[model samples]
Target: MIKSKKLMYQIIAVISLGLAIFGVITPGFPATEFVLLCAWSSAKGSPKIHHFLHANRFTGPVLNDWRNGKVISLNNKIFSSISMLLCVCFLFYSGLNIYFIGFGLFGISISFIWVWSRPSHV
Candidate 1:
């Protein structure tokens, strides 16, 4: 990779990885998608980071499942669904504008559908 391109990939890897870690703790935030992004970028920019992700006990299985066939386990699907539901409930009760709530509901609905559509196994 060109120097600039490599640097760009490294930046993406670092940012996405950080978000992934954050998502692990934050309800309604996404981890798998960010981890996938980090892994893909790191593969091109920093093999060491890529290796570390694969070797990680928590992240490794998610990455492996994704690589196999974009599988999202049943437990994870259930967890995500509950998280989204809670987020939507919070939004409605938080007294946000109706338009903003509608927009959030729309986005959450789409995300819910996509996550459920993924296979549970290869």
Candidate 2:
């Protein structure tokens, strides 16, 4: 059971990592969240995979900063906030149901607030 569970986790980690990598080149997809999810699943499934991600040149520092300090860089904060705002704007203008628009706005507002509340990594 343990082995099977580990395998499942490894699979999830790989899939999330792939999506995160794809997000790097695809606009409107957030890579950081996927990368964090990958890290978490890898840690549960395979220490080797976790170490690789944690030691990777591009991802290592980000993971370390988030893990150690719960810090988000100013640039990231700005980008996230802008993205959320844009999404809210698009939803509002897309002729969606009023309830859906309201929910989207509420969620985006909450996310924006949370992102700004984090310590800036500088």
Candidate 3:
């Protein structure tokens, strides 16, 4: 049972890490949240991966800040807000449906507020 659980965790960590990497390259996808999930799963499954993520220069500070406190850097906040706004604009122009547009706007608004509410990393 323990071994299976560890394997499951490792699988989840790897998948989350892959998505996180993709998110870094993609415009709208959020990477930080996926990295946090990867780190959490790795901690349970593989110490090696956990240590590496913690030590990594690019992702280390982000993971550390988020783990220690729910902090998002000012730059990240700005970028995410802009990206979300752009997405909302696109959704509005898409003309899928009034209900869909309203739902999308509502969700985006909530996400925008949550992201901005987090403490900005200094």
Candidate 4:
């Protein structure tokens, strides 16, 4: 059963890995999401791509920490903080805002909290 699950993860990882790369040149694609998904899959399945990701000095610690069941880190928190600030500033300046924009903000805050709330051994 575990093996089957790992295989599923591997397939998904490959697809996400492809999408991540493709997103680099695609206007409507979000490269980060796919890359994160690929990282998740590789971490869970022990794939070669996981090793590649882990070998990166920047991304390795975070991915490895996630694989080890740690939730968040200072780096992610700072990134999220900066993102939130930028998004809020953009919303204020662009005037393309709507009532539901708060919901989006709320969601971002929630994700930040959820990911960073737990302590990691890494």
Candidate 5:
């Protein structure tokens, strides 16, 4: 039963990631939610995948750091920060004024900071 649940979670994570990836080219699409969902689901679903993510050469450091409860990688942290910055830029550029998006960006930024700041052994 546990294995089945894990498998289902893995499937959900993969599907969510796929959708997030596809959203990349779709206008007005938000992929971050799906990516986050994938991360969360995988973290709870399978230790193997979690370990793989933790040890991944490109993303492992961040994953492991997250698992250990440490700060996110400088690269991911910078990337996230820049993304939020771009959201602000886009908001200003469009002049349409969707201020709520800023809140989401801010929230995500805070989440990253919180996770990264956790002890490096979580």
Candidate 6:
């Protein structure tokens, strides 16, 4: 990759990783998704960063399972599902537009099904 493209990808990876970290600290944020995004972009932009994420104790297993078989462990499924549900609940009570609530609920329901549908890493 050209220097500019490399820098762009690196920036994306760092931003995603930052968001993933923030998700860890904040409730109802999807950390794993951002982590996966960081891994992918880092793989393209910076092998060292990819290796670091894959070697980290907290992140390695999830990355390996995903890379190997697109697996989502049952524990992770439960955690993510609950988080998503909580977000929807907040949306329902946020007094936002009915359409916004409906859209959020619909999206969460689809995502919930999709996440639960993934094969577990047995």
Using all chains and alpha carbons, the TM-scores for the candidates as numbered come to 0.93, 0.79, 0.82, 0.61, 0.55, 0.89
Candidate with the larger lDDT of 3 and 4 = 3
Name the lDDT of candidate 4: 0.69
Query: Which has the higher lDDT value, candidate number 3 or candidate number 5?
Result: 3
lDDT of each residue in 44-106, candidate 1, tens digit only: 999989999999998899889999999998888998898888889899899999999999999
**3-36 per-residue lDDT for model 6 (tens digits):** 9999998999999999999987765677888999
* Clash number for each model: 0, 0, 0, 0, 10, 0
lDDT of 4 by residue, 11-49 (tens): 988899799677655532344457679898888986698
RMSD (Cα, Å) of candidate 3? 2.0
Q: Between candidates 3 and 5, name the one with more favorable TM-score.
A: 3
* Ten-residue stretch with the least lDDT total in model 5: 23-32
lDDT at residue 80 of model 1 (Cα atoms):
86
lDDT per residue (tens digit) for residues 53-82 in model 5: 456564455545554644455655555556
By lDDT, the best candidate is 1
Candidate 3 lDDT: 0.86
Question: How far is 37's C-alpha from truth in model 3 (Å)?
Answer: 0.9
| Most TM-score-accurate candidate | 1
Tell me, what's the RMSD of every candidate? 1.2, 2.4, 2.0, 5.0, 5.0, 1.6
Question: On residues 60-92, what C-alpha lDDT tens digit does candidate 2 reach at each position?
Answer: 987887998888778777777666766776887
Clashing pairs in 3: none
- Where in model 5 is the C-alpha error above 4 Å? 1-4, 19-40, 43-48, 97-122
Better of 1 and 2 by lDDT: 1
The models' CA-based lDDT, in order, is: 0.91, 0.82, 0.86, 0.69, 0.61, 0.88
Off by over 4 Å in 6: none
TM-score (C-alpha) between model 4 and the true structure: 0.61
